[model samples]
Target: MYKVIRKILFLLPPEEAHYVSLFLLQLICSTPFTRKLLRNFFEPVKVSPITIAGIHFRNPVGLAAGFDKNALHLRELSCLGFGHVEIGTVTPQPQRGNERPRLFRLPADNALINRMGFNNDGVVTIAKRLKYWREEVQPYVDLEKPLIIGGNIGKNKSTSNEEAWRDYEFCFERLHPWVDYFVVNVSSPNTPGLRALQDRSFLEKILTGLQKKNQEMKNPKPIFLKIAPDLEWIQVDEVIELVLAIGLDGLVVSNTTIRRDALLTPPNTVSRMGAGGLSGAPLKERNTSLLAYIHKKTNGKIPLIASGGIFTATDATEKFKAGASLVQVWTGFVYEGPAIAKNISAASPV
Candidate 1:
């Protein structure tokens, strides 16, 4: 079972275990024989199909952005039965990100804290990979439905707030033809002063620029804003207002939170782990509350993609009840293993 494999993986360092797991999965998925066997074991489950932001999803469960930052594992991950897979918080240029020991696991709280700082291959390289997928690889998968891909983008750490729009625009333009949708990420806590761009004036500027560029495309992709859970109601309201005013497609109802209150993980241990956004079970209450609030405020008119703390069918159902049209998983996927998407999709409400 996954618990046994997880125990072995847990013995390794968090970040190391991640790459090892992905590498193995990538290898398994590379060959059609292994890929078919894996897909049979973890078959896709179609629950209530829904269309959000003009894209049709075979199911509501999706892989959250941070899991596959460079679009490397889309073929394999899709076999695990996610309706969508979002890649990147990709910048215009590749980044080294923060120092090592940046990712920590809190088994007691079922949470992870990461100051990864948008570490990823830059837009150009990632776009090339995607181009191959579209032209060469996609024809082979032959699924019943197409997997929706979301491009989650942000600025490089060295980029200033004033010049941030250029970075976002660069990514938006480059990824436009390849990705099914786009998420503007100005909410990550790891990047210094990045969250400042979430302010109404600055957000308007960045989003409007992306939207303008998006319109120039013969087929403009759906654009969504990924917001932090730390924002106050007033701030969230302002975001809703901007979303409506700009005619943006939707919102991803949170990134990870910087707050670390009430965790079962001891204070000393948590302090040792240090600064980064905390995600997983500890995030459930706050994440769902924010979902409900956003749903209520927007009168359930604006589509929402719920992230944070979803680990089970019940969790996905809770998000649906709270007004999320789609749900994404990152920490849960780490904990629950590859069967998660299939399991959650099977258990989802009719």
Candidate 2:
């Protein structure tokens, strides 16, 4: 079973283990016979195709943006049965994220803390790769299957808040043609003061700028805002208001939380890990609260993509019960492995 294998995988540094697994997955998925064999291990569900922003999702479970920062693994990721795979916290310029040991694992809690600092291959590279994905990679998969692709955009670490909108705009304009939807990421804790962009005034500038350009295009992609679960209720209220006023397509209810309160992991060990957003089992309750709050604030007018610590069918279903139209996974995928997406989709509300 995966538990035993996971124990061995856990023996390696978290970051290296991730790549090792990714490499193995890509290898298995590259061949038809092996891909089908792996597919059988994932239980299928009666997917209720949900329509949002005029796009159809065969199911509601999606891969969160941080996992595949560029589009490199879209085919491999989508083959695992996620209804969508959001790629990138991509910036205008590529940068090596934080230095060595930026990712840490809390095995006892089934969680990860990362100061990846938007480490990515950049928007131009990602966009170019995406063009090939849409043109070539996707066609080989099951037909008209998952929503399959999204671009999650953010600013470079070196960029100032005043010029931050330009970074987002750059990614937005370039990636629009290939991705199904756009998630504006301003909530990550790793980037210096990136969370400050969640401010109403600053967020308005970014969203408004994107929307203006979106309208000018003959084909406008659906755009949603991704927010941090660290937000207070008043801040959540402001975000809900902004989404409504800006006519933004939707909101990704919550990102990783900065709060380390009451975790089973000892404070000193956690503190030693240094600065980064925390995601996994500990995030479930607060994540649900924020999603339910956002749904209540908008009176369910805005579609929500619930994400935080989901690692099981029940956790993802709770997001739906709290009113998410879709859900995404990062920590959950790490914990549950390939079965994660299918498990949640099968448990989705009828």
Candidate 3:
């Protein structure tokens, strides 16, 4: 059914097709009868819940960060059965991201290349939306388990690296009350100089500041660092050292990669897609290896939420075997249709 629908969607630009499909789903979900019908067909079978970082996830499958940039579709997305939905990469201030055609599809590689530049409705606005969901919508949702929400935060493009910690701190404070957990995203390739925040000196300042603030609160949220897959082993070691030093909650094993090697997509075709992070099947091996490396290095002390290349039960099972406590899907959700979370959760060992 999705294959046929996908063919028609494929005719439109990737970003256009994204909103159009979600809009349709939003309409379908607006009513009780249709929403229940949608849930009946798409929700995963009930499974034992798992605890990670002191939070309960009904299942291991979650929708990754970039899917719902703002907190706009939580009600509709919750009906699709993801155990958690990560929103943002939100900045302290809203900004229009890079130019159009920034998001591209690599069908041959079952991949997507996006240079979205952390575009979002900013922290304050999104925090308000989350507050409403927690106060109004969440209590009424009928489901076997509660849906967890994660805030994925980042700095604005105009913010200098020296002052970046302020941006992260601002978002951390505003969103702390509303989200279940927080992912500090410093690895997106699209934003200029953003990846530099991953450096030990810069990263330590930002993370330490956030942690200090977190401790001041009565109930602190779990905070995780999201890293790029392209990092060298030495860089990974630095990240591990910092995570241990700060007692950070966990790690979102990867963001997307800047490297485009070993792709089934033709060189000319991929080159046309230009400079954006590459995600999907090409990312599985390296991300899985990173998960194993970090799990071993930390002696399994640091929790891992695997992202990149997970499209099926086999892919998700590979993540669990590699030491991921939870898994997130972005490209997989786009390529696999609405049943992705249900399908993966139904078969996941975790």
Q: Give the TM-score of candidate 2.
A: 0.97
Poorly placed runs, candidate 1 (over 4 Å): none
lDDT of 2: 0.87
Clashes of 2: 0
Which residues of candidate 2, in runs, are more than 4 Å off?
none
Clashing pairs in 3: none
The prediction achieving the highest lDDT against the true structure is 3
Residue-wise lDDT of candidate 1 within 223-314, one digit each (tens)?
A: 99999999988999999999999999999988999999999999999999999999999999899999999999879989999999999999
Task: Give the Cα lDDT of each candidate.
Answer: 0.92, 0.87, 0.93
Over 217-308, each residue of candidate 2 has an lDDT whose tens digit, in order, gives: 99899999999988888888898888999999999867888878877788899999988888988888998988888788778999898888
> Which consecutive 10 residues in model 2 have the weakest lDDT in total?
38-47
Task: Estimate, for each residue in 198-305, the C-alpha lDDT of model 3 and write its tens digit.
Answer: 999999999999999999999999999999999999999999999999999999979999999999899999999899999999999999999999998888999999
Stretches off by above 4 angstroms in model 3 are 142-144
Q: Name the weakest run of 10 consecutive residues (lDDT summed) in model 1.
A: 137-146
What's each prediction's TM-score?
A: 0.98, 0.97, 0.98
